[model samples]
Target: MCCYVGCVSETAIESIRRSTRVMLLFTELTAVLPIFFLLQERRPWAVLGLLMAGVVAIIVIRVRGTLLRLRGLWEPYSYARVYGLVAAAMGIAVLAAVTGSQTGVFTAILVGITASEFFVARPLGVASRHVGIVVALQSAAFWIVVVSTGHGDMVGPTLIGTIIMTSGLAYSVGLTYRWWEGVLKLEQARRDAAELATTRERLRLAEDLHDILGHALEVVSLKSELAVRLTDPEKSKAEMIEVQRLARNALRDVRALAHGNRRTDFGTELTGARGLLDSAGIACDFDADPTALTTSERDLFGRVLREAMTNALRHADPRSCTVSLAVTPDQATLRIVNDGVAPLQRDGEGSGLAGLARRVEASGGSFTARAVEPASFEVIASLPR
Candidate 1:
């Protein structure tokens, strides 16, 4: 069929381009054959009839190309419907006009070409129900014309066959596209589930760290008070040593809390400790400079102090508490001193301290706690920045 050649998809355009060449050659061959054979037999009318058929065929191909171009430019749905309707109408009109002409065969051939072109380029239901309706109607109309004009013998039942074939092909392709879309949706769901799991794991780890370190700091605070009030230097020294060891352990746990692997901050810790203690009416006084520590280091230390302060307020009764923070290029430190002593009857609870101790030392930091005077207890932490 003749069609506008310029506006088609690469695939459709290529098909049209190839078919145009082939159809033109075929039309020329049909035109030449009768002239060569029938003209010599003195059948000029037959030769004329054949020549006119070839001309009509060529014109049909050109028109189809134009329609194909239009089909390509139209949006998919509109393209399908417009092309189907136009092809059907053209086929019916051509068949009706050439009913008794010697070129009646040519008209049937043209109608077949146009109907098949409609199916090939934009099959039934390719775009919408409207496309199917147009194609079906055209096929039926072409059949009616053929039966009425007695051209059905030459044309065969091809109009009906083409409609059925194209409808099946279009339906199958549409179903395949829908299936692929469903698969894509499933892949997206899987990704969302994985992301949710990762978030839950992080929250669990954070909460565990908070629980472990908070318990141990309270124990160190109690022990320091007992050691400070001891009268004998040797006993006091022994107690102070134990206090230092406990403080070191506490710092270790803080490191574990901050890093989960290694590294802890000491400066920010002191400030945090001071605030927690003061909030509890423990009168925490503190000072610290964290210029040498990185943001992570400062934060780790802060967490340890936070644990210490929580313990002081929850377990110990103190008149006043002082917290001091100091940081240097090589080291970061925190000290918390509170007035009053925890009784020695019960062993200090190391609930959160054990975790904090592991945390601090993992980052190459140290913790200490001791008794300073008759009524004072202190917790200290040091970390390598």
Candidate 2:
């Protein structure tokens, strides 16, 4: 099972970050609306408010552009333009403060703080630290202006508190964004690793196919050319027969490679089973009549035998095993019984056994695997003749 951190694509994360930034922008706009209402009480303040509102609009637009550039949605050159706009907005704010337009000064401070937050979209370390310093200085200057104008009581203690809180919040948001970016990088790395493994597997399979078929085709080609040159009918006939055998062998190899499972004969499987059982220190008693079964039955029984032997060796600590195959007029039956049975770990069969059962049933066969005794296991397969 996967851990609790959860897995998500990079695109979805970006969408969530974008939505969060937009919501922050709306929240800031709502917070600043009170300044506009205060400006309506006087002509100079009203005129200054109009000018500040225009400047704020420009700042907001530039901020959006900066965000796009930071997120890699825009060209790198676009960053310089956003920086220029941010500098202009700060300059206008300072000009308003020097001219003694309180409303203008207030607007400028708001824009300056917001412009500082944009720096969070930049790479971390020195740049972000520098932005933090700039925001702190702006907040201090704003507090000083509010106190000097005798409007400290109007804005209350929350004025300076808001600035400090905002700076901290912006820093936290930047760090979180960086952390999510790292997660996305790790996800991409995992995907690349999986792709590399698949490519390596394909290359290995290609090399195996080349080794298996290349020499055979070369031999057949040479023999066919020799046959064409031969004058004797007997010599040509012999070369053609050799060529046909080589072709059939090459075709079988290709089929085996494609299916990823070699076609085994029953006799070969029996020999292999004895060898395997002996190596595992398990005594085996095997009885079978391979000649009684037809070619198709032999092939199916061969697979069943291979699967049964493999499971017994891998899953059981058997001291003895018995394998028997019986062929009647209508059907063939194969039974594999082994001692030293181990309890199943999971509720159902493993994928290997389940797949084998499906293959047998699909061919009009019946398959059963179970514990026949406390310390013994059995597997039986019966197929139509």
**What lDDT score belongs to each candidate, Candidate 1 first?**
0.52, 0.62
Which portions of model 2 show Cα errors greater than 4 Å? 1-56, 59-63, 66-123, 147-159, 172-198, 218-239, 252-385
lDDT of 1 by residue, 304-370 (tens): 6666666555656787876676777788777777666654523353545555666677779886655
Question: How far in Å is the alpha carbon of 20 misplaced in model 1?
Answer: 65
lDDT value for candidate 1? 0.52
TM-score of each: 0.31, 0.46
- Model 2, residue 76: what's the lDDT? 28
lDDT of 2 by residue, 1-385 (tens): 0232235555665675566556444444532553563354454776566556756676466456446634645232244553565456555554455445344444444444444434443566654665565566555665666667666774445355545544554455445444444544555565676577688568646644553454356556656877898899997998889789768977887888788875657886787668656644689999987888877778767766766766665566789999998888898899999887766532246555565676678789999887776678788889986
Model 1 residue runs over 4 Å out of place are 1-279, 290-292, 343-349, 370-372
RMSD to truth, every model? 19.0, 13.8
Best by lDDT: 2
